[model samples]
Target: MATFTKANADYLRNTLQEAVVKCSERCLYQSAKWAAELSVSLPTLPSVSSSFDADTDSQMQDVDPPPISPAFHFANNDPEEARLEAQDLSRYLLAKSYFDCREYDRCAAVFIPSALPRGPLSPTSPNSNRRTPTKAGKGKGKDSGVITEVGSEPPSNALPKLSQRALFLALYSKYMSGEKRKDEESEMILGPADGGSTVNKELVGITRSLEGWFADREARGLSGSNQGWLEYLYGIVLAKGKTEEDAKRWFIRSVHLFPFNWGAWLELSELLNNVEELQKVVPELPQNLMTLIFHLYASQELYQSTDPIHKELDELENIFPDSQFLKTQRALLYYHSKDFDEAETIFSALLHADPHRIDSLDFYSNILYVMSARPKLAFLAQVATATDKFRPETCCVVGNYYSLKSEHEKAVVYFRRALTLDRNFLSAWTLMGHEYVEMKNTHAAIESYRRAVDVNRKDYRAWYGLGQTYEVLEMHLYALFYYQRAASLRPYDPKMWQAVGSCYDKVDRPVQSIKTYKRALVAGTYYDQGSSFGSGTTAGEPTGVLDPETLYQIALMYEKLNQLDDAASYMEMTLAQEEGPEEDDDDEAGGHGIGVTTTTSKARMWLARWEFRRGAHVRAMELANELCQDGVEVEEAKALIRDMRARMESGRSPS
Candidate 1:
């Protein structure tokens, strides 16, 4: 047996005390193991005493020992008993560390034995007969003395509340890992766990254990910080199980109590979509982390101007003067701000520093493509394809460059390769759909868009693509369904509303078409008002100059509904749009004559016929004469003229 010497006792006491004070789980386990191996009784650490000097006392006032949890207490003074207690504590700590690192199987193995009661063994103990007979003896059956029936035995050791909690967490981790693997294989975004039977059991166990812990801590009036940590973990579990709102409430409560919890801050930022809110609590976070949050905000396009992003980047640069990551982020901010030239300059420097930076490569390719720098884009794509062929983003960039060049077949190959590398690459899926649409493969386009939606249902682009594909196939019902879904997801998008309105018209629902077109006009008006230049329309105009095509469609729908007055009103609006300042030069020729000249001719002839029917002889004659000036409508105008002249010559009142 090992002797418990004074020196060993002192070393164990100091190490354990320090471990407890630092809250270092790994160090605690090591110290506990050393004490058990040496059979040393740990001495109680002395209480911190105030210094006699007033100045020193004030400085040392906050140096008191950390409070120990009840689970960490040793009830015996006997050396042998203390050694056993230390061994148990070491097991607990080991189990906790494994759990924290997400090694669930190891965590479960260590925790089950440490937590459950262990009974003393007799001659017929389960451990004694644990070994099975060899395979050769299997054919001999019971006569060969092979162990068969394994009976359950009661545990001698009582389970601790903390151990029970750890056990539940281990099981929960295992369940979540399984779900994550499934999501990866299926190319779905990682989100809340599906309610599988096994997962539900684990969730129930975790919830029960957590509730008990909360109850116990509250009853004992424990430290609020510890309770806050509990809440944070509870929030994580709830979030994994798809209870987002519930999880958000818990995260808010956690940060309120423990303001320094960075994990809580990050989760809250995502839930609220407001990184600025986190600054109120964690003002002194590391510059790298702060820059990352700002980058995330920029990526989400949350800021209308670059002022706020530039300010944050400037502050970060001041703190981390030589940080390459911050420099890359600054370039990204420039790109988001639409300063393409400045962004290109910064990205060029970054790529020069590290030629293989994937993010820089991705963003630079996109910038060059947007700028119509075709030669540079092709060069970058070629170099990236040669060097980083396996990277999904590289493949995607190459695919995009080819797609821009109208090389649809070659682009499809690279896009498919990107998807093979990362099935949930939403951009790849969407780009592939565009390629298929360009190739005139409506079926393939629909499939690609469907896959995109399967990966992320909230992807409005995917829904809109599906709607377009269906509309092209003349599947009005299907088009209407997807267009409605897309509109719901992005109600501010006028294009989606227009698509819905067109689908209604195709299905012969003129009233619904009118309503949908009106909705589109309202959305367009708001969009223009919110923009600096009215999105290519006259600033501050009512309805903000709706798409000429949309206006024509609305007029046609009104004609179908036999509301000729409204139809004429809308036709006049359409003709006026063609003569607006933004009119294309091609309108002078008949090449792009879908606007004023052609549409107005048709509208005028229809209006004349309607006026003649309504006994408005003068108005009908004037409209007919205007139509007669155009050779294309001369015969129709002459026929209308003859009818109006005959009606007037009868001298029977215009009707």
Candidate 2:
């Protein structure tokens, strides 16, 4: 009996410690294991025989006096308090096991023996039945579940003083269980697709109940040491409902006190949409090893790099040596920089090591499409299909194959198929928009781009596509809004600036147009110094405005303002800049590359016409004769010369 009491007390201590330190999947397993090991009823002392001799009974009273409860010992100065604590610990064991094993419905049922199928009982409230859990330990017992009726109820006169640690675990388990069930329901709605996100009314109500509990506890000064975790949970719900700042505060508070909670860090990271927002909250977070790791992880998700993050990657490698995940990030950074040549070697080595890994295979397909390497894309598609025929990534690759072949309809079909499998596969929406544009289905294209933006506001591809579609439809106002949005997201991309400038011109805002075009000329300086802009700088927007289209556009805008001198200077500047990103190209993803927009002869011709209209007859004649000598724009040059000489021969003042 003494041994049993000590063992049970030790079990109680271990459970509480584990609950406080790490009570998610690991706790669930430990609790489940305990339940299996201690499945029998609590040990009881044998009743004293009624037929003992008078002397023996007298001696028994002296030698072996009636024992205190054998397997329910607790360290409380008050015997009653110890007994109550011990009883509560015993009663909650089975339910904790059920919850840890993800038998949530059963977990709740066992929470209160008196209340069937209605708990994860409150430690403070006699009736509240809220519970939560992280998503894990999916398997449930098949038969003879660890417990049916875990234990008898405690006396009503004195309620069991359940440990706060045990109660929190049960609450978290149910939360996780709620998410798991929601996913299952979503998966069933449209075969593979989640039809939409539905509010989990159950979780919302639980959170509402806990709010009052937290308030009451604080009022009474009974809110325990574990309150930080509760705040973290509350923040998660707040974020889901878009109480933006409130969620950040709660997460900040939780992590400041409990820096190792990875989920809280991740939640906080997701709430911050940009560097400015992230920096605002960083100082408030704990300066610890886990927080350091969080920074390394979160930076990749938040920023669109103007340079490769390989330096950060290398720093992280000091801690996570030879990490596969780090290698993948390095490869992705190269891909982002559009440095396919630099990325190619790393990707080849990765593929050679793990031929079936689909981590960056979709990107590989996109690169192939850009290069017009049709055969290579086909081979990639086959490998992706073999790996997982129904995967969204595979569908994206197949879609790219059809796109490269100019089968726009086939490409759209596959892209749509990818969406059906996973609506949040952001690239599918953008890719589908591209195909719709090819098919001249403007309305469909608009809808696809809008959906992509809804999924992720950082998706510059979708924003740019929407701008282009609006421009095509002559909706310059709407086009300008999206172009500006894309430009804000990718500030160093001259193409985005150019789009914004050109849209301003369409709307007859020549001053703004000229200003924006000039910004594009100096956009490269804004990129990180000595970084990998070489590969990532999309062809037309090469590190600087190498193609000089921006200069030409600035000159055109100046002409619109009737500023002939500025226009002539900009036109001369255009000759000083050349080649890129060929002038004929549209956006990189969907261009035919047969463009002639920025030929030197075209700029010269425009400059000559503008000079002549401004009454500079001598300069116009000089430009016209030069173009005619080279046979470049000869017909237009001759026509210009005829008009110039006619004006001179007629002897009227040139306009």
Q: Which tens-of-lDDT digit does each residue in 1-655 have in candidate 2?
A: 1122333323323333333334342253433333322222222333222221223111112233233335433234445434544666764677767765668756644442232122222334332222221122333211111101113121121112344444455555556666566656655322444433543334554454345445444444454444366667777766655565767877887776555455677678777767687667777776643455466556666544434345556644543343455566666666555555556567667677777777657767776676567787898888889988788889999999999888999998888888867766877888899889889898888888887887677777788889989999999999999999888876766678888999999999999998898787677445422221112222232233344677778888887898878888988767545333333356554322222333566777877787787778888888788778756788988998898889879987666
Summing lDDT over every window of 10 consecutive residues in candidate 1, give the lowest-scoring window: 530-539
The best candidate in terms of TM-score: 2
Q: Write the per-residue lDDT of candidate 1 for residues 408-489, one digit (tens) a residue.
A: 9998998888877776576678778878988999977888888787656656667888988898888999999999988776
lDDT of 2 at 419: 80
Off by over 4 Å in 1: 1-176, 183-223, 227-237, 254-392, 406-424, 433-458, 472-475, 526-545, 581-655
How well does candidate 1 score on lDDT at residue 349?
82
User: What C-alpha lDDT do the candidate models reach, one value each?
Assistant: 0.58, 0.61
TM-scores, in order shown? 0.53, 0.67
Q: Give each prediction's root-mean-square deviation over alpha carbons.
A: 16.8, 16.7
